[model samples]
Target: MGTTPQAGGTVAEPITLSTGETVSVPLSTEATVYGAIFSADRPAVDDLLPRGLEPIRATPRRAAVTVLAVEYHRIGDEVMTPYDEFSVMFPAVEAGERSWPFASLATHGASGYVWYLPVTTEPAKALGVDVWGYPKEVAEIDHDDHVAGRRTTVTADGQEVITLDVEAPPAVDQRQEGVSYTVKDGTLLREQLTLDGRLGAWPYSGQATWELGDHPRADRLRDLDLGERALARLRFDGEFVIGAGEPVGTV
Candidate 1:
């Protein structure tokens, strides 16, 4: 069997998925990301997590809510169509553990529970749900970049779900690793992601703006009681690699 070479000088063996599609392991992508981190009510955040997880409070009463829009320019070494994706995640930890505040954002061992994930392509949505157990749906995700900044909008069923506007800031070279927790068939799935790129971060200061529409998904986020302004806004342009997810425990 021929081996497929990947980034980092490693070779990935091809495997056929349950969907009858064949792809290389450890998916890689080149994307431009726009993100905003908001502070939400801790109890409200916890209400949305699975049984085995608890919200990671950024403060005694506040939890972190993250919204990200990724514009994928390439996937793996094969020629594929580009797609846009938007996600909502909450910083969380396994139950029965001491929850760390803001430190959870940068520290290892913490996981982000994906609450809503929408992609523009069927293949992307199918792969995410079938492999990683990500809560993915096919939606209209539009990513627009301009000389000034970027704007991303997500719509479903002819109704707008959410829209985020981010201002461009100067970036610095950085690398980050993150873990994500998802649920499939009542089992908790853990996936690791590594990113290498130039990161641009800005403190809230009323610089970032987001609006929720009448869609039910938007209403769910509205119920979270997120802070009036974002805690931080970020932009990253670089390489992203997602490892296969494995079952960690029952959800």
Candidate 2:
């Protein structure tokens, strides 16, 4: 059994799932990702967060929303059939914390609240929810590569949810560390994340487009008043590590 390290200078024991499967701590994966950050109405974003959390404003009156799709190729040291995922996230900080806006992203000072997560496999959904309280549902996620870039589509319950198209560009090596927040059983949880990869980004020059569908799940996002175009688009290819979640406070 591999021992995993926690953020608070302790080692985490493997978790035994309800399905009788054991998951090691500090989950690691190799994946290809495409993501974007969009501007949204601050008040609307605030309404979506749980208590004790506030939106990190990208601009006065405008918060930020992140949408990303990932294709996981391996887990731990084992290579497995790939699984796809699509996620919607809100950049936020704890209530009463100073908001640094754009600087927060560069410095990893803000926590990401996952609003929605759809995955292609049952294990992915189960592990996400059971381990970290990630709000995950099994869905159909399709990825296609074209000359211009890549297109990802998410469908759930026979209805389309969202589609994202991103252009490929030159990437530079980068490493990032951040925290993510989730709520489970009335408790707020925090997980540490680390990523090393080649990252490509483009400012809002029409390099990407995100479209929401008529699905009810999509309506939840529509309420945010997401901008017509993303503030920036990103692509990353490399490895990611997720630490065990620790409860921070009651929700």
lDDT of 1 by residue, 60-131 (tens): 778888888889988776534678899899888778877676666546322489999999977777678877
In candidate 1, where is summed lDDT lowest over 10 consecutive residues?
102-111
TM-score for all models, in order of appearance? 0.91, 0.91
- Candidate 2 error regions (>4 Å): 1-12, 79-81, 105-111
Candidate 2 lDDT, tens digit per residue, 1-251? Answer: 77666434557568766655666767777889888888898898888899888888777778998888898887654523458999898888888888776766544422489889999977777778888899999999999989978899999999999999988767899987788999988888888887788877776647788888888998988888889877778888998878878887897
Clashing pairs in 1: none
Clashing residue pairs in candidate 2 are none
lDDT (Cα) of model 2? 0.81
lDDT for 18 in candidate 2 is 61
Residue 129 lDDT in candidate 2: 89
> What are the runs in model 1 whose C-alpha is more than 4 Å off?
1-5, 8-13, 17-20, 106-111
